[model samples]
Target chain A: MAENRLDIRYVAHLARLALTPDEETKLSAQLGNILGYIEKLKQPDVAGVEPTAHAVPLINVTRPDAVGVSLSQEEALRNAPASASGLFIVPKIVE
Target chain B: MLHRLTISDLAAKLARREVSAREIMQSCLDQIARVDGRIHAFISHDAEDALAQADAADRELTRGVAGKPLLGIPIALKDVLAVKNQPLHCGSKILDGFISPYDATVVEKLRAAGAIVFGRLNMDEFAMGSSTENSAFGPTRNPWDIERIPGGSSGGSAAAVAADECIASLGSDTGGSIRQPAALCGVVGLKPTYGRVSRYGLVAFASSLDQIGPLAKTVSDAATLLGAMSGHDPRDSTSVPQPVPDYGAALTGIKGIKIGLPAEYMIGGLDPEAKAAVDTAVKKLAGLGAEIVDISLPHTDYAVATYYIIATAEASANLARFDGVRYGARVEGADLAEMYCGTRGAGFGPEVKRRIILGTYVLSSGYYDAYYLRAQKVRTLIRNDFLQAFETVDAIVTPTAPTAAFRIGEKSADPLQMYLSDIFTISCNLAGICGISIPCGFTSAPRLPIGLQLLGKPFGEESILKIAAAFEQDTAWHGQKPPL
Candidate 1:
């Protein structure tokens, strides 16, 4: 069995996910199993191996800085959960 | 019956002026209405809009505009892609009610080729699960056996094609999402070499791993779709600037090509029937005058482990944009933090939440080096293993999945077991190469379809397509349809 190193509640908090009691219990067990499986990564001798972020090498992919057709404000706001006068509405942040 | 025709067949008929695009669209809509209740291949489709597009295609055909390959074809898209004025749900509740204002690059290309695109097909939430059971809407059942899963997260794409609900469809493969489902549902699916198809409007699951490809009735059909879809898009910088090759012209034969059978893939856990099918496929290729060489991808065992860490870590960062403030569903709470937590807690399904948490755990400050960084380094080893094997062989052959489609609920309870469902197909994505799954054979009594996988080097899609087309030509497996 793989050792349980995952702190479910803490991780959930970091991910901005509020978990129910039932979900907390289930996720704790399932993620433990997955982490145990992931422990296999330690076995590979990856000493001095360069980490590959992208499979195909991409460097300095720049295009001409010119204006192009852009989405209208109405179109951008069309799908927002709450919008008023072209601005998306979010829960209050200031106390 | 027109809906049952492959893209190539439909194209030939349309060119001969024997059929109109509207008729083809009607035929597909009829099929979807007929079998979709059982297969659940589509989340939703706009019949009126599809027919309108088809009518326009007919008008274009009347003008004698020839040479467009996908012209008059009715294609569906997995729900993960953004289609203009269409709902863009990644089979998750978080994206409910969200409609894209613009088409994805692949969708634009398909439109340019004159395809009548409609339907938001089902998939695993955020392209996360091996079985479509994780979809927030519902699971897409296999056409072969309604009780079993259509391998995911491209389940709906593969299932729709198998049931003749669409001429063909586009699917995004992050792990085995495209190939595994194609194997289970008995269709042709290809994951183009990474960056071969631009990911401009694909809802990001794992940015580095996500790729858009095709699922179709035959290898030639897949080749047609890939040709229409492949190109460099200035919008997606990761897209390769290499000129697109005419893949159809490369389907001559594999007379002198050397195909490799990796020893690591024939593991003990592989279903005996699947092994037999692949063994026979190798022999058939050998008989076709292709050399069969034994090869080893030594780091194969670590693939699933490497994939889980890197994919989930990337997903954690990518999916962070789904806060309730911007678009889609929202849940109210007291403050900004509470709203974010509450919305995510309510919106995401079990699998999505589990992965997000797992991803967050790996990328957290203290554990970053131990988990995410190590996994990335190990990924280098996995990629090297394939590069080393490709040195002596032009392509590699294996079973697309370890077994045929299992029951819908069979592995859903155990996330680890579900993760293992992708063991055979995940490494291809990790290696950033092209691969295809074609129907090879079927299991007896309560029969299910099995698939033969062909892997090609980066940008070597033509070689694998040639091999797949040849194998498909000499065999009757691709001709068999489900009892549906």
Candidate 2:
């Protein structure tokens, strides 16, 4: 289990969430409880059963190469919150 | 006239030209106008556009074309689905004004079948929580009891069908979003085999687990919707290319079918009333000439833990796309980094942020093996347990939820408790099987509906539907409507 509070901070940073002190405390406890519950998986016995990733047996379902309709620039830009020159415009990246 | 009709009945009417597609769409719009304020099932209603589509269907019928099975029927799209030219807020403030450029494959199929896309229904902020309370727009109230929630993420779709706002609605089930709400609202919900339906235009929550299905008032209606919506879409790589079964043909009989009841699901922690209702349902199935067997899914208890780690970890990665750069809401700041932080922080609800953080942590470098990898390994075990159980049974039955829908704020504070609401339904997703939740019996407390879940082997939706249709035929459980 992840015991350190700093770990929560690090994860929060990765997620880009700014957590208040109170939120950090609450989340730590909640995450701890969840981890404690997950620890139950350590007790289940599976001697030789191989882990199965997907439920279905079949795989490699591929489609033939075909051309498809692409959305018109005007249609695509219709929903943009901010657009310029028929393109999605974003805030400047560099100073 | 169309308000009380199921999708199949509406189809029959459309086939006979007794009602034009425009008439059906108008009726649904009228119903929404009358009752939607109280139910709040829809976040966006496009009455004119729906009516125009209906007009086109009417024109097709007039030209003597063989109308599609769903021709002229009105259906609701969960806000999570991308409907072309409509704002797909996904019940979040961040994407408040974002409209989709193209239709989701399911939506496209529905339109091609002459079904009118009426509106976008409410959902949890990106389908995260069990209760619709996570919606940035207010929670959808249960049509049965105003004080309670319609079980959520897909709550709006379920509530809409229950309230007769739409004949049927499309909802995505990741961790029981469709079935739980359907159970709570006394409707029918089907979670098709994973990748059975295309997830092409769905905003990702947990990509591996998320599947869009239907919620309707009857099993046949759900089957109709499922049949119309499912197909291999090249846009979605995970979508299966298997032949689409005639879902309507599966409703024939359940005689001699073997149904398994996992002993692990029947133990402690289930609400007594809910359990009794499920027991009664099992007895009814047995009485209908179906054989019932006690089966053990030994890894059932670990499903919740395994599911959270995998789902959240996938969610963390999938949701990283919403960094305020492309579409939707963005909070401005001095620099790109601050803008990204401010945008996401302000845009996502608390639950979404919490899960994203948890998911990110689990998938982080050092912790990956301990959490994400182990969860994946256990997920394999979970899937194997189902595969092993299926060797002896045609389908497995359990309660859709451990308890009936609680009050709006009941489990909001405790995320674990909230996650447990999907305990009975999540394993089906993990195992990549088809499952359905149809109203089984009513609980004694609020007299809210209890759902009996039937889970079938992978791509075994036909068997599950056969059993569910059998149960519906023998009992009035599916016929009972919630008093709004």
Candidate 3:
């Protein structure tokens, strides 16, 4: 196994995911094998090669400021799991 | 039989008043009723809405109004693309009970082109897996053999076209999701050059890598669908302002085009039957006067590692919006943080959770420079390899997947083994180039289909469509239907 094995529980928390104990065990083993295979990336000498974030070079695109027709408040809240008075509802955070 | 006709043929019939659009839609609905029970290609479809659209198309035809190219065609969409008044689950439970209030840019274009966009096909959850097994609904079976998988995450799209459930369907590719399944299903699939099609309403998987394309029964059908679904949308900044080409007209011939064959792709793991199929396809291309040159893409081995790092990193960020607040399903907890974790834990499938964790770890503090940055630099080398090869050859050719479709559950136990299935197709997405897969031949024993992949340079859809059309014209492979 790779020496820098991932802390699955911590990573899951970082991703805002709650995993069962069985899931954590299985995922850790699978991800470990995948990372081990990825260690081959060290074989390539990519000195000074510019990283490509987008395959096509794109400039910061901006459009002219104008008021355009937009979705209605009703339409926006239509799919919300819980909403009231044109606002989405969620659990309390800073009570 | 009307359901089995290509888009071009169906359009001609509609134009000549030989068949009504409703009749064509009825044939498709009937076929879906007959075989979809076995193939499981669709997650849901609105038959009443489809008939209504067909009737509207018939009215236009009756008035002698010049119809749009895709007028009256029955097209399905992978669930990842939003359609107004339709459920958009993205093959995961996280999106439970959500309905889209607006159409994606591609959906609007399809509607504008007079296509009846109805069914939501199955896919790997968040487009994460190589086969459809990760779907929350259920896995779609291969049309060729019921026990085998339809290659995914566009498995349902390819299988629907193969089984003639609908005239054609749309799918997204971020790494080999579109072409791999198309290959395994023995149909035509095209992944246009990055920025070739607008991604404005697509659920973000890997924003930098995701592209929407067509899967169809014939190369020309794919061409027609691509034409309808392509062009610049000011809404998507990544959508290039390049003019859309009449791809249907690009099918002239490949009399003198140079097609490169990368030496690295003929690796040890490649199945012999698939290898022999590709070899024969090369000879067929040569017989049509296309020059086949052997080339080398030295960085081929690093693509899967590079793809997993970058794609998942993007995915981790894109998927953060699925938190319990705004839309979709929510599993409430005592606090906000607990709600977020609880909802995601209950909603996401095992594959999706694994990817999220891997992505979080790679992009975490102290690890970004090692894994994420290194992968991006390696990505540069991989892209350069394709660009350098394109300088000499117009396009490259390879087997779309390493082998034919395997039985379901064969590779699902091991994620690494499953990832290797896309080894031959992922480099195209990393390079931001256009690629197509067409049925080349078939395996004899179980009688499964094999695909030959042709990849073109950036903004080079015309070249590949032309080459694929020429190859498809001379071969009868695309004409063979699965023994459903």
Candidate 4:
């Protein structure tokens, strides 16, 4: 449809999502259809236009540094799937 | 019929001692029990807690608490907004069994207003999709016609309001999520200007576009909810600092207001019945002594494409926080990378996965300029188009969706077709303006509700609400309930 079929495995890997074979096949086709629709923008001339990240222009918003109520460690990790010793747990990364 | 009372009616009755908060709560609970079996609008509701809150509201009412506007009204929260101690699943398997440790800012505001917040309604995962069909939990059937879909990802919110499961509900709109479903289900849905309401607790879908607003049975009811929920929150920097007006007071006849009809919104392929309804609405506006000017938003066609790029890119970044370590359901593996991959692989639904991949692809090296940046630039042009049109018109009018609610699974197979379902509503989000969808008319064959969307200038909700209220006052659409 476009230049090249999306490297579904590559993009999924970059997104840190593990997809099964069936999902990859189904998604590739769906994405291809969406991208083709998006290609319609080629007809518009958007040169020299500022990219809008938000609806309104935002400046660097800063607040005065002050101490305030902070969540207790237990409250912070209340929803953690695995935790030990007042901290969130994850699979061992270092051997 | 306590469940059928408008928020204002309920508040007035509670103040006059004509009804107690507990009585109203019981009535809603009973209604839910009788109807929810077929509607499934709710994911989970704590009846005991809801009643407890109602009891507390009664105590406050007896104690002569001066003025708590929504002191005892039952309001449903779309699953994405985190309510303290409530399971915030966001209609996704990824976050199942997770309880919110704290209330989102909106939840805090609602509690302060004395509203009895209850029930987490169903939605498309992360507020994606045009229909509730994208929910990992089964789709929420339309209350209007059970065989048809409740437009989504705020489908459940609209259904609950239409079916009187809750007096009014809060829903988040990223791109027609609030209004489309409200339109299809025959209720009033408002997507406030992007920053008018705080986004402190709304689960991020597309950060720039996502906004939290109200869905209610009437324009005034929607106004009541908005007044209570609006204001600047330090928790959300984007929350506008301007004083929140008494939106309810703003409701009045549009005696001589200027309205615009954007020609671009009325192109061919629009459903003929919907077109007729909007045309009639324009005539009615003219009859009300309102000036109707023909306007143009030339860049309308590029909105869907621009939205997909910007929303997907932002969504990819926001959803990255869902890795297994912090919270949510997890899958274990030998290593950290494997754990992340395994959990995400299993957790996210197909539609979610497709979006993440598309987003990632657009933001990837070498493609950033070609896709993401171009879309943003085009987004500015679209915004400019609206700003120019607003110079003469107080607000613009259009169909909320191209058609009435279609049958469930109708567009599920074609994602592109589903994306186009929001064609008329997407530009408002891109421009960061406010909009509302009110039941304007209906289609006869299967008898589905149609909506008239009013687009307002940034923070110009009062203008649209007044126009909508006036239109609503003269019309009978807002009063028509689903046959259910």
TM-score of chain A of each: 0.91, 0.70, 0.92, 0.91
Q: What level of docking quality does candidate 1 show?
A: medium
| Runs off by more than 4 Å, candidate 4 | A1-4
**Overall local distance difference test of candidate 3:** 0.93
Residue-level lDDT of model 1, residues B1-484, one tens digit each, is 9988888888889999999999999999998888999999899999999999999999999999987898999999999999999998899999889999999999999999999988999999999998899899999999999999999999999999999999999999999899999999989999999999999989999988999999999889899899999999999999999899999999998999999999999998899999999999999999998999999999999999889988999999999999998899999888889999999999999999998999998899788888889889988998998998899999999999998999979998899999998999999999999999999999886689999999999999999999999999999998888887
DockQ of each: 0.73, 0.54, 0.73, 0.73
Q: List the residue pairs that clash in candidate 1.
A: none
Quality of model 4 by C-alpha lDDT = 0.92
Residue-by-residue lDDT tens digits, candidate 3, B203-293: 9999889999999999999999899989988899999988998999999979889999999999899999999999999999999999999
What is the Cα-based lDDT of residue B452 in candidate 2? 93
What local lDDT score does residue B383 receive in model 2, on the 0 to 100 scale?
87
Number of colliding residue pairs in model 3 = 0
Q: Ranking under DockQ, best-scoring first?
A: 3, 4, 1, 2
Instruction: State the lDDT at B423 in candidate 3.
Output: 98
Q: What is the TM-score of chain B in candidate 3?
A: 0.99
Sequence-dependent TM-score of model 4: 0.99
Q: Write the per-residue lDDT of candidate 4 for residues B1-484, one digit (tens) a residue.
A: 8998899899999999999999999998998998888988998899999999999999999998977889999999999998878899898999978988878888888889999999999999989998999888889989878999999999999999999999999999999999999999999999999888888878999999999999999999999889989998887888778789999899988988999999999988799999999899889988987899999999999999999999999999999999998999898998887889999999999889989999999998878888899899999999999999999999999999999999999999999999999999999999999999999999998889999999999999999999999999889998888887
Q: Model 1 Cα displacement at B176 (Å)?
A: 1.0
What TM-score would you report for chain A in candidate 3?
A: 0.92
- Give the whole-model CA lDDT for all candidates, comma-separated: 0.92, 0.87, 0.93, 0.92
